[model samples]
Target: MNYTYYGMFLWLPSVLSEKGYSLVHSLGYVLVMTLAQVPGYLTAAWLVERWGRKKTLVTAMILAAVAALLFGLANSTAMLIVCGLFLSYFMLAAFAGTYIFTVEQFPTVARATGMGWAAGFGRIGSALAPFITGWLLGVHLGYGWIFGLFFAILLVGFVIVVTLGYETRGKDIH
Candidate 1:
């Protein structure tokens, strides 16, 4: 979702215009969201160490999903920007945690390979997401459906991480 959102939001100004927002409004939300991401990255780095990887990952994932949903449902500009800020924060935090967790999941033998595969998969999604998102929005299904899809996708990722993940905060990577 992090990567997808990066691509998806590149056209955010237009997307918001579709929802009856001005270009200035769209820029405001995107700008604030960008600023919000910094704290998420910093806090995730701290939480991954203090709270452990799995916990931080799951929490951020959940927050991201909720925020995406809210962003989709928002009727007003203020609500939209607020929700987007939160969505950006948690999504970036999840991204950071995912990176650390993916690295920790592999042993020395295939650490590089595992990291490469994981990032490659993310890139593929990022590459494909714009088309899919454009289609979803093009259908005029509204922000609710488009953002709902994002919410569901993030939830699926959350489930996969939780189901397949193990706690690795203190474990020595060899």
Candidate 2:
């Protein structure tokens, strides 16, 4: 999720320019997409309380993956904007839920260490994303391929969550 989100957003403007959009338009689109993050995080906060952490993260991952795929396939400007907006929204929401969920899993004594480590490991993905995305583009893989890769990764995350993740919702922390 971090890889996909950071990779796509980091390279989005360049991708748009390569797709023939003017730099100004590309930046404008990116701005609009980035602005969606605020509400996405807010929504995650609400869903974490209402739907629980696991469900919120899983749902956000799935939706973000779909939105990314759709954004890649989009031919019209409107579709691009709409799909981009959704992709940004759900990705950030997933991150928000992840922060809340991960913290809840640790006992107080280890909470800081656990949170720091988890976040640090996640940043590894973020750090690698730009390089990989650049390589993908350099190799001439199309947008569909790029976003399809993200879709696959997100599904893997969903599976990991389903298989290994236990609900932390309403549980008493040690």
Candidate 3:
């Protein structure tokens, strides 16, 4: 899941370039993406307290799907940038919430280990995403199709979280 989230950012620049955008445009798009995540981090902190971890994660996944789809459909560079911002926002929210959720799911003795493993596995996904995106791009799949694939992956993540995830609201961490 974390892998998929990080994968989106990994391939974002390549996707932009495939669309005929310059390096400056890609960098600016990245800035927009990063800036959009700030609010999500704060919102995740609050939403986890108010609604609980499960709901927050589920909601973030849904938003990720919407953002991903919009990103794939965006016709212009500006529209793509806007979708990128929205994608970053929800992805960050989901990412942070998962950390909190994972930690809460384990006992103290193994909590750190579990969280570490989860994070590590997510990084593997992140690592693979760039390669996959590059391969697809090399084959001339186009930015729109690449983003469409991302949206599909995010949708799967949402379903996984909703079906297999647990509620961890008001639980003692220790």
lDDT per prediction?
0.85, 0.91, 0.80
Residue-by-residue lDDT tens digits, candidate 1, 1-174: 655475457657778888877788778768887898999989999999999999999999989999988988998878888998898899889988998998888999999999999889888888888888877777888887888888888899989989998889988889
Candidate 1, backbone clash total: 0
Ranking of all predicted structures according to lDDT, beginning with the best and ending with the worst: 2, 1, 3
Ten contiguous residues minimizing lDDT sum, candidate 3: 1-10
Q: Write one digit per residue (lDDT tens) for candidate 2, span 1-174.
A: 888988899999998898899999999999999999999999999999999999999999899999999998888889999999999999999999998988877889999999999889789989999999999999998999999988988889888887877788888878
**Deviation of model 1 at 10, angstroms:** 2.1
Report the lDDT tens digits of candidate 3 across residue range 1-174. Answer: 555565667767767776788888887888878898999888997899898998988888788878887887889878887888888888889877887877887889998898898778778888888788778778986666876787788788788877877787866666
- Count clashes in each candidate, considering only residues at least 3 apart in sequence or on different chains: 0, 0, 0
Q: Candidate 2 regions off by >4 Å? A: none
Mind sharing the TM-score for model 2? 0.95
Off by over 4 Å in 1: none
| Best candidate (score: lDDT) | 2
